[model samples]
Target: MDADMYAEAIEYELLTQAIYKDILAREGVNTVNVQHNVSIVGRSGVEHQVDVYWEFKQAGITHRVLIECKNYASNLTLEKARNFFAVVHDIGNCVGIIVTKTGYQSGAAAFCKHYGLALKLLRKPTERDWEGRIREIHIKMTPRVPVSNETHPIVCCLCLRPASEDQEVRLKNSSEQNPNLVHASPSMRFLGKDGQPITEELRLWIPRQLNVLEREDGGPYKKSLELTDHYISANLGNGIELVQVIGVLIEYYVETLPSNEVVLNATETVSAILKDFESGEWEHVHSAK
Candidate 1:
C-alpha cells in the first residue's frame, strides 16, 4: 500500500476502536479501549511491550482482552493467539486476539472456535458502497461561511484591533464594508485585551486523506462551488437529505480548511477541491508528489 492506503489503514483501526467504544459500549455491550505497546514483566524477568490490553465485563464476568492489530500483514496463526493469551492469562482472566491485515489460519480458527477455553477469529468485511463513506467525510469537511477580517478578522470580529498574523479569514462579497476591519496594523495594537498582530499564516492546509474523500463524493449541487461540493460529496449514499447534509459541511469546512495557503498551494488546493466537486472526478487533478 502507498501513503494514502497507509493512512486509511490507520484510520480504519481508529474507527474500529470508536465502534467498540461508542456503539458497543454505549449500547451496554462489554467493551474497552486497548492501549498500544504495553510493557509487562514475564516469569523470566524479561519485559516486553504488549500491543493492546483492556478489560470488559460480559455476563457479569470481567474479562481482559489483549488485542494486536496487524494492518499491513496477511497471515496469523492459532499458535500466535495462544501465546498472546497465555502471556496475559497468567496476569489475569483474559482473552487474546490478533487482528491481521488479511484472513486467518485454520488452526487459529479451530482454537478460537470455543469460548472460555478457546481462541477467537474475526474476519474483516469487504466494503459495499464506498461512495457513502466519501459523502459522509465531505459533510464533515463541508465549508462554512466565507470569512473576512471585518466579519471574521485576524482579531476578534467584535473588535477591529491588530490580530496575530497566524489567523485565517473567510470572506464573501459584502454589500457594505466595516470601517473597523480588524488587522495586524501597528496602530491597532494594544496592551491588554487587544491582541498582538495576527502574524501567522491566514489559511490552513487540508490533509491528503480528506482531499481524497472530497475528490470522490463532491458534486451535483450548483450552489457555492466550495460549499456545495463539500455537501454533495459528504452526503452521497448516506440516504440523508441534501439540505441537511450540505448544511453540516458548510459549518465544518468554514470552521476549518485554510482560508488561504501558507506557501502558494492554497489557491491550487481550493480550486482543485471545488473543481472536483463540479466535475465529480478527482482523476484530472495531479496529486501532490
Candidate 2:
C-alpha cells in the first residue's frame, strides 16, 4: 500500500477502536477484551484480517464481534458490503460491523441491513454538522490581586517608639505564664488577652481598618491600628522590656488584573465524530491527549 494509504488505514482503525471502546463501556461490558488489527481463523480454516475485534463470555458462552474499517473518500459500495457479509457468515456465530469515513451507498446499506450487518460512519466534523452547535467558546477571566503600596513602621506602646525599615518586632503570646516569642504575620495563631486565638479576628479587623484609612485619606495613605487589645507584647531587641503593641502599619489596594480571553475550538479538540448509518445517532469522541 502507498504510505498515505497505510497511514490513513491505521488512523481509521484507531478511530474505530476509540468509538467501540466507549460504546462497550457505556453498555456495561467491562470484562470484554477488545483488540485492534488482529486475525481470527474462520470456520473454513481461513484466517481473516479484522480491524477491530472483541470477545466476552456471557453465561459460560463466548460471544465475538468483528469490525472492518475503510478510509475511502468515496462511499462504500454493495460489493464491499457483500464481502464483509461473507466474512461474517464464514466466521459463524460472530457479529460484524463496517465503519467508513464517507458513509455507504444506498445499495450497500440495503445489503448490510438484509444481512443484519452493522454499518457506521466516522470522520472529522464538517461545517454542516456544526449547525446550531457550538464550534468555539470564549471565556473571559479577570483576577483581583492585592497590591501593597506602603507599609508603616510598627510602634512600641511602652517606650513610644517606632521601628525602622530594617527592624523586625518580635511578638510574645501573653496568655501563657511564660509567653513564647512568635513571629507576627496575618496567619499567626497568637492568643489574645481572652486566651482565645486572635488570628481570625485580626484578619477581619485589619481589612476594616485599611478600608477606614482608605476612606479617610481619600486615596493611598499610611495608617496604624492596634491589632489586639493588650494581648500582644512586642520587643524591639533594643534593651527595652517587651512592651504592649500599640499599632502596626498596613497600606494596600486591590488591583484588577487585565482580562484574558480563552478560546476553545471543537474541531481542534475533537478526535472523531462517530455516526450510525441506520439510527442516524452520532457522538463526538474527544482526544485523550
Candidate 3:
C-alpha cells in the first residue's frame, strides 16, 4: 500500500479495536490488543503475523480471538477471505473475524460463513443505544450586532442549559481569523422550500460539559448540577432573525452528567445542523441509520 492507504488502514484498525474493546469490555472480556503482531508457526515451520488479537480466560480455559481490518475502497473479495480463512485454519484454536470498512461481497461473506468467521462493517454507532441516556434543553438565539466598531460584529452563540440545572454550557466561535464561526464536521446543510438550495453564512459551535471528581486527599468533589458554558460565536446576519431548524445529526452519544442529566461530551457534538433560520421546529433524528 501507499502512504495514504497505510495511514487509512491504521486508522481503521484503531477504530475496530476501540469498538470491539467497548463491546467486549461490557461482556467481561478484559484482554484486547490493537495492532498486535503475532507469530504463528506454520506446518512448514514458517511464521506469519496476525494483526489484531484478543484473549480471555473462561472457566479455566483461555479463549482466543483474532481480528483483521481491511480498509479497502471496494468490497472484500472471495480470494482474500479464503486467504484469511487459511491463516485461521493454520493458526488453530481461535475465533476469526474480518472487519471491512466498506462491506463484504456475497462470495466473501459466504466464505466467511462457511468457515465460521464473522464479518463486521465498521461504521459510527447509531443513536439507538444512547437515546434516553442524557437530559437536554434546547434554546434558539440569533446573532446580535454590537454598536461598538469591531472587526466582526454579529455574535451568535448557543447556550444549552440541561434540565439538571447545571451551570450554562457555552459554545463560542473557535476560529481566530473568522471570529464568528467554529469548525464543524460533516458540514451544515440547508435547503429551501422549493427543493432548491439556500445559502447562509453560518458559524459552528460545539458545547462543552464538565465533570467533578472527589480528591483522594480528602477534598470535596465540588459537584455542580449545571454545566459550564463553552463559547462558540457565529455571525448569522446584521439583525435578529429566525433560523428554521429542520434536522440535526450527531456523531457521538450524549454522556450522563454528575447530576444524572444527559449532555454531549466536550470533545464532540452535533455534526450537522440542518436549518433555514426561519422556524425553530427541528427534527432531532436519534437513529436515522
Best by TM-score: 2
Candidate 2: where is the Cα deviation over 4 Å? Answer: 25-31, 145-255
- After the best TM-score superposition of candidate 2, give how far the Cα of residue 274 lies from its true spot, in angstroms: 0.8
Provide backbone clash counts, one per model: 31, 0, 25
Model 2: how far residue 71 lies from native, Å = 0.8
What would the C-alpha RMSD of candidate 2 be, to one decimal place?
Answer: 10.6
TM-score of each: 0.34, 0.61, 0.44
Per-residue lDDT of model 1, residues 1-289, tens digit only? 8999878666545533443344345567663565545777655666755555567677999776665555545556677757755676566667655545454577665565453333222223223312443322122234433233344332221122112222212111110243333222323222222223222222332111123333322222121112122211111223322111111111112233434323433223321110111123322221222
Please write out the lDDT profile of model 3 over residues 214-269, one tens digit for every residue.
12322212222222222222333333222323223222222222333344451145
Q: Which portions of model 3 show Cα errors greater than 4 Å?
A: 31-35, 124-289
A best-first ranking of the candidates according to their TM-score comes to 2, 3, 1
- How much is 191 displaced in model 1, in angstroms? 35
* Residue 127 of model 3, lDDT score: 55
Among the numbered candidates, top lDDT falls to: 2
Give the C-alpha lDDT of model 1: 0.38
